[model samples]
Target: MASTSRLLFASSFSHPSLSITTGSDATRDLWLKNRKVPKEHCSKISMQHNWKHSYKCIDGGSTRDKSRGKFYINATSSQSHESQPQSFWKSTKDIMHTLQKFVMSYYLITMLMSIISSSLLAVENLSDISPKFFVGLLKFIIPITFMYFYAVGINQVTDLEIDKINKPYRPLASGKISYKTGVIFTISCSVMSFGLAWMTRSKPLLWCLILYFAAITCYSINLPLLRWKKSTILTLISNIPSMLLTSNVAPFLHMKTYVLKKTTIFPRPIVFTIAVMSFYYLVIMLLKDIPDIEGDKAAGLQTLSVRLGPKRVFWLCVSLLEMAYGIAVIMGATSPFLWSKFFTVLAHSIMAFVFYYRANSVDPEIKDVSQSFYMFIFQMMT
Candidate 1:
């Protein structure tokens, strides 16, 4: 009976007009009419047809049809498999976009500055620049990088609306990354930062991370009385000390205590670098707002640019930076080492002139112009 049923089923495909129906009754009728099969066998064929139909539904693929004599593949399964790489690529792109817009340059600049400062101040001999030195530097930088991301991520999360106005290309602002994802990313970064800092068992590094975390929290978090970024005075207070610590003092102390196994001492270069960075960060805090005046105004954020107008604030920042450069020149000239004096004086002089030229070229009335200048300032920092 089974052999006969199989022969009948194969022969059914010979009739091009024969339609396969999912209904058991239709299938049984067709089989009986076409194959002249016995009544008892027809029930088995009908049951087979129903089972095939159920299997097709469950498998998400089409069953063989008599008319076409072809099996249909599972389209949904194939499409999902094909899209896995594309979905992964898109997610990766979104993450890169977020980093570039939010913290990529800042992270790179911070790491570069920290490494340079620490190496200059801590490394005294050729033996100091070894594999272990680099490994220790990596350990120090990893936690700091995580904290930097945390700080920027929290700011982006809190300033979503403002960023939509000022930085729409950002992941959170453009809706490429959900707010929940941003919050999760920030939390993860903070956790990883603290965890790594704890693992190092370095008090200076741990305290620096704590201070940075607190500073960013106060600057960005929109609690009832927080969000220091909305006020100029509070913004300066929160930013300057954090920048000074992170840029100069923290790295020096971490290297001296953690890597070099030496007592902490601020050399003339370290102190001078701190002073220069303090002034530079002050200018940065004010200059950064110049391009975002519109967004700040819309958000009711009383930034220097929003309070004093962009043109006035622009000149103010440039003048402050110029004065800082002048101070650097004087300090460099007075340095006891000839090479130090020559390098610092010449570099600052050249940079000051270049900064003046760039500042003169920027028109505060143009948004893109001001924004480009803001980025240029970051380049200068690097």
Candidate 2:
């Protein structure tokens, strides 16, 4: 995780406190000269009793050490030895650290979660809390919390290459979290995510879980393998679950609850607003990838902006609000006088787009700055 974090930092290491590879030719050539296929080389090493080994990060990323023991670049891929030592406190601390790193680094996940939580709180706008919103919170938190952890593990597994090049500081990539350890944490999160969602016993929860699985699988692995990271439609759609999850539970929690004559929970206009709000988040996320374009390209990642050219994507990002607002006004006008919904929708749309456009200068730091601005504005706007 440290290595990956360092790589992430190094991916855009313009900061004075950090040092990372610039993906230069001298480095590549050095790696090639010293390179040996990890699998073939590691299989020959003996993994005996407990002993610590170290690898030096030479200019070419080749391992050398005074001990001269074999080093594994991706130990997870070639895990040998009986098993890693077990300790109750060690395990607990490890998982906690992983979760913390994930939350701290990915502002989008945190922001979306905040929005969802706040929106659900908004559902209480007109009334005190009840079973419906109680259920809604259950529906909202479990799926997302689980997905966040799951995403961290899966993203780490897939991003080993880029991490190696740019972020060699993350714990996992840096040998802080071993392959066995990472797998354990990933599985733990996945199982917990499913179990927690199942506990909710809500249709929305189940559907969201399914959607989350599909999105990660499709975007993180399948589509990338197919090299379709570009194409505005596909890239944008892959992020729907995240957007929807953030907005899904809010409307049901609204203050004005119309009880059907039959006494079952009735539909509210709040639901559509959640969807509209989520769309706004998705647009910013799209713009957030700008800095990563170069690193992603070097790593063979073809995200939408990377494929379409960042400038086009930037303008396209600016246009999304017009498109979204147009859709919202058309649909709302055709319907009833849900004036509150329209204004809320318009307000969030403008706020999200305006902040996102201003924040879309460059990626990495600029994106972080943009995200910070967006979060601040979103809080104020909401």
Which candidate achieves the best TM-score against the true structure?
Answer: 1
Overall local distance difference test of candidate 1: 0.77
User: Which ranges in model 2 have alpha carbons more than 4 Å from their true place?
Assistant: 1-95, 103-128, 165-169, 222-233, 249-268, 271-275, 322-382
For residues 342-364, write the lDDT of model 1, one tens digit per residue. 99999999999999999999998
Q: For model 2, what is the alpha-carbon lDDT of residue 367? A: 43
Candidate 1 segments whose C-alpha is farther than 4 A from its true place: 1-103
TM-score of each: 0.77, 0.55
Q: State the lDDT of candidate 2 residue by residue for 1-382, as single tens digits.
A: 4533443333242212212324444553444345442432332222221135322333122233324634323333123232444455678887888656643454444445554554444443445456764555555566666666776677776666666654566766777767777668777887888887677555555666677766765655544343224444666676655555534442233222321112224344455555566656666667656645656778766677677776676666556755666666556555666775677567656765665666465343454443454454345424
Q: Score each candidate by Cα lDDT.
A: 0.77, 0.53
* Shift in Å, residue 225, candidate 1: 2.5
